[model samples]
Target: MTTFLQLHLLTAYPPSNPNRDDQGRPKQATVGGAPRLRLSSQSIKRALRVSEPFRQGLAGHMGQRTKLMAKVLLDRLLAGGMDAAQARTKAEEIAKVFGKIEPQDKKRPEAVQGTTLAFISPDERAFALDLADKALAGEALPTDKELARTVLRTADGAVDIAMFGRMLADNPDFNRDAAVQISHAITTHRAQAEDDYFTAVDDLQRREDTGGAHLGEHGFGSGVYYLYACVNCDLLVENLGGDKELAARGLRSLVRAIATATPSGKQNSHAHHPRAGYVRAEIGGAAPRDLTGAFFTPVRGDDLFDASARALERTAADIDRAYGPAADAVETMDVPKGQGTLAAIEDFAASALERQNA
Candidate 1:
């Protein structure tokens, strides 16, 4: 049996484009013929990874998802009293192990960027930098294979790397497969794009200058989103090098972030700092299931936020009743006002996850 951890969350966002389409409107998808607002899985994951609570949980055990590999390496070398020009050159060689370098200057001066943001942890970067320093000092360096092993090895691939995984195109052998799956969040009801038309008055505007100095329109919308994510605990542990304890801790942090982190889109205007009004947690060795079917017919109500959450809860109950319980342990955190609190949900999830490894 494969252990799985799953969450169904309902979050309400105001008239703001947290996730936008190419046209700058709230992202939307046609669901069952009705257009529904959407927040992409990529956006949601990035937000959670950078959230304050999530970062605090992982502490310094985090990877830098940046293209600035040369800069990172050069910083280390320069700190060790190496000359700037030499450090830049060596950094390029070291960075080549990870991916292609996009030198900042067309003249190929010094600074370089990785092909993409390679998700390498701080320790891994340090190791690679040290290896470069040794090579520069005429010290005997390890073979290429041994050097790759030394640089790629880690305690747990850092928190973000373990959960989201990384793909080093330069060396596919070091790639870590992601054990967590995220479903793009979609609203439970139809939503239409709305535009906010406004004008900004220039401080030096004269009374004869008429209405305003600048006028433009911004797009936004509101919806109650149904978000889902699944974590294969066994695979996650394997991804973290068979550390079940660390995997469990990572699961808890992930759940907490999922419940609280809102993508920092146009927050100054929308201010969408929403927590899940409801979360249904399922922990089992059974196959994970998503309750997106609950909104196939669209839930309509005067109070859509509460209605959306209620609809999800009803669907989960209906499925369990008909399918004879699809999970080993299931818990629902009804976090609407007096029903429960976010803290309570986090506690419930943590306790339940702890039981899985035990």
Candidate 2:
């Protein structure tokens, strides 16, 4: 049985803020009149990393690396005897077939030396050409070109499915739905309060305008979290078993999987917000201070191992607690014997908390 599971997280921001605001004060908020640690976008991103299938999967395994698109094309074109300018032009055409390229620089020219490419859109053609110049100079190819191809082929379909495959291979039975739920929980755990207080442009000419607030109610707080998840139901059914009851039990696992965090950086680097959220730690009666600095935290080698352990323990427990009753309730549903078994399993899952309580 692929009983082992885990979710790893790297804070999107620094742990705490070192700088203070004007009047030597740090930003803070009171939750229930008690200090709720101010959280940064990094903190939420890290917490959600383990549960996000796309991120978690790509983190450990090889992804569809387009970094070599330009290099590969360049080499092929050169082999066919094309000049640097002609090579880039032809290579660019081939690249379009695969994916869009970005913009290039004019003033600061890039050295079009070796096979090099940067993944970009049509609008970013300029950047793509610029990066290609550097790529050519180094004559370096992406380390895992083949691996990237394999993943990208699938990305062409349900991108999350390929992503989930990688995540499942690493986590076994991990599913996309579960990962999403977890992300939602982490994201909604605490909402930021808008700073609606009026700013005193001048004491006598105070205006009724919000000050130092984020966009959309709270700046840097509200926005779509472009989440990517992949789920392998077959893998899940295998671990859980063909028995309807057993399959039903899998729902809990699914929920937990969705709740796990996905890693950041690399493929996931651009997944989160430029500025996510943060958590502040306060000492004594002092105000809360922001902890995170960056948008996402990079996973360390040690974190890879620790993340698995943590994901398994939490996901397993979450499944058991979240699915028991749901599984039992499945029995009440109208269905054939085999189907009923599945229903029972689902019902039992509904009472997941009861099982954990037991």
Candidate 3:
């Protein structure tokens, strides 16, 4: 059983520069016009993946895909009786079919283009392109099979954090998106506090107050946080082939496998010294905390993976209690539910089965 779990984080206090056109204050949107915090969606997602839990669980797969597709294709070509050169060519072709470019575009860095090819094998790439060409020509094609195959092949692939996703999956009451959004909000709130602390503190003032609020050993800021994540078992199965009932069963099996598997742990350590600069607050003012680095001292990859798995198992029990057994079948699995999009998928899968049985 395999599944694709995606985690997204949005800052609660998305910041906005004072709406002043080089003059007096202008009307700004969002809750009382209190200046908002600033952080990109990409930034939050990246941070989550780099969190101790995700780094520990999935490891390098979450960050880099440099030669993944090339490797996939090379293996395929060997299986298909092609020589090294021929295999490479076929792999490139397959990559191209799956939206990966060959020979690297000049405007784009090789690193960026290479990442695209890291996920697919040459044969699958070739199949996908062939499927597309046939569709364009009005020829019968195997779209579902290709999608299913891709999902199956990458079943164990950990491309992102699972903790957040696992939480959403296990707890039917939990809203995955809302959870991520809240996490982002918390980080945003922390970031703003740090920014304010930097603004307020000076060498002379710190000395005046016995260096209490002075920036200490920590360099970047402790407000920064890393979030590890995982998704539910059924969710993964559904994403792979768009099948709900099958996914739910897969999810159950996954839970069993996880129970038997050795647990993983996080490795990254806070980079800066514990005594760092003070953070400004919305009301209570400045306070000191450790400064987590931009990279967060490279936490262990195992921690991230383990956290997600654990979170998912707990979440699953909760979900079953609230949603009951997923009663749908495979085909109509995309319609999402109340933050429980995965369960909604299960319902659809069950429904499909009922129709088939009827």
lDDT of 3: 0.31
TM per prediction? 0.91, 0.29, 0.31
Write one digit per residue (lDDT tens) for candidate 3, span 60-88.
33323244554555565556565666555
The superposed Cα distance between candidate 3 and the true structure at residue 329, in angstroms, equals 28
Worst 10 residues of 1 by lDDT: 349-358
Question: What TM-score does prediction 3 earn?
Answer: 0.31
- A best-first ranking of the candidates according to their lDDT comes to 1, 2, 3
Cα RMSD to the true fold for all candidates: 2.3, 18.4, 17.4
Off by over 4 Å in 1: 78-86, 154-157
After superposition, the stretches of candidate 2 with alpha carbons farther than 4 Å from their true spots are: 1-61, 65-68, 75-82, 108-161, 164-182, 185-358
Q: Per-residue lDDT of 1-358 in model 1, one digit per residue for the tens?
A: 6777788998887788888888888888989899888999999999989987678887776788878877877787787778887777777767766778875686866556776878888778888878877855766556667767778754464877888878887778888888889999999999888899999999888878878888999899888899999887767777777776667667778888998897788888878888887887887776678999999878897988788877887888898898767677777777555575666556655554455655
Clashes of each: 0, 89, 48
Off by over 4 Å in 3: 1-32, 36-41, 47-52, 55-68, 71-87, 103-183, 186-237, 240-358
lDDT of 2 by residue, 1-358 (tens): 1111112122232222211223222233443333222433333333333344334332332223244555555665566555767677656543543344445447633322223222222223333444345444644433334323322222212222222223222212222222121221121112232332233333443467535343321122221121212223333333222332333333443333333332332223124423211111111111111111111221124433233223433443464465432121112211211222323333343343233223
TM-score of 1: 0.91
